[model samples]
Target: MTEKSMLVVSAHSADFVWRAGGAIALHKKNGYRVKVVCLSFGERGESAKLWRKGPDMTIEKVKAARREEALAAAENLGAECEFFDLGDYPLRVSDEALLRLVDVYRDVQPAFVLSHSQKDPYNFDHPLAMHVAQEARIIAQAEGHNPGQKIVGAPPVYAFEPHQTEQCEWIPNTFLDITEVWDVKRRAIECMAGQEHLWEYYTRVAQQRGVQAKRNIGITVKRDIQYAEGYMRLTPAVVGDLS
Candidate 1:
């Protein structure tokens, strides 16, 4: 069993599953703890998938459905999920709110923190989430620079891929093999009925990533699998004597 747990900081409800469902499922199957912090209920730019199902869908109804989908997806991946109820679209974060996010990091005290990349040119919330997550990660250490930060160890942080981010030079500093857990990833993605339309596309994204990884020698990776995930480290992960 993997001893370390991971905290996933997402801009919206479905972003986590879309980017790292394979990784999340891989961790869970290895007995690692997984927690998701959704910065928003995906009220604005992201809720269209649900609201479009019925023209009369109210804001409250759409939110409720999205939450259910998030929970179901997390359950499918064997991880605990929580929604922060933060504002969507124009993601505004106050110092107080960011500190609350710090509290989550301290409370969870995860060894690994995964979040959205900061370079998403198209999505406003994605960059905001990245900022909050980056601050929370640094603050979690409670170093001398920021006395207002929550007291916790500085966990290793990584950024997951996004749609626009793929073309924006995402150099993965770390890689985790998710071949065995690919099926779990597929199932977790299937839980998002509202966004079911994009599931296959995401699956293909993973497969493409796997193919890219195959070029590296001395790492025997099977080509039959059709799913993979990638991440770039925000800070170095001191695992052992890699140097």
Candidate 2:
């Protein structure tokens, strides 16, 4: 319900959809822009879903389809998307990679930066993304550290919940209300025909979180609400009570 650009970095292309699409859509509808940076196209990460399409699809073709699906999904959510094309599975964040990512942080300088939680179920890009983003936070703030970095003044940064709750350490202090934009979120997710199965998969996750939020606040967050996204402010975001 606020107006400010947000940058989301994910370990894979479809991640922004399954985990954070609702928030992305809500952000855009509220006059907040968004940019998603995927560390990989998920080439080696997992392709059984994509391969189920047919036996003839090549690796390149699957990757291309994923990018197409992601771009379409992002647009539907009112956000733009980009992929670093880093090989998935065993993504390594080189010192140079850290510098490069910081470059993007500098260029976008989004009011809020989002990325994977440091904890994840798998042993791959999720942790790499978390580490890279964490380093970027510091590198972006490091004066004269890399004059070549493309972003601008540092913005508020946040960490998002991962796909597997138990695998990653996700300590979310902020729960965004996507009830108003839930439909738009659903529509955006549908764009990922490649991940239709995930719809049913994540719906439950959303419901669980919604119930948790309501219990914590002692208010019922309607059942029509099927999805939500969570985050923890890396920097304090104080409204009215600036004390």
Which candidate number has the best lDDT? 1
- Candidate 2 regions off by >4 Å? 1-3, 53-55, 146-154, 220-226, 234-243
Candidate 1: tens digits of C-alpha lDDT, residues 1-243: 526778999888889999988888988887788889998878777876777777788878878988998898899898889888877887788888888887788777787888888777778788789889888777777666356644667777788887865665677766556788888878878878887778888888787777666654235644554456778887765676774
Clashing pairs in 2: 106-150, 106-151, 106-152, 107-150, 107-151, 119-168, 119-169, 120-168
Minimal lDDT window, size 10, model 1: 217-226
Q: Which ten residues in a row have the lowest lDDT in candidate 2?
A: 218-227
The Cα error of candidate 2 at residue 195, in Å, is: 2.8
- Compared with the true structure, model 2 gives a TM-score of 0.85
lDDT of 1 at 3: 64
Task: Compare the candidates by TM-score and give the number of the best one.
Answer: 1
The clash number for model 2 is: 8
How far out, in Å, is residue 42 in model 2?
0.8
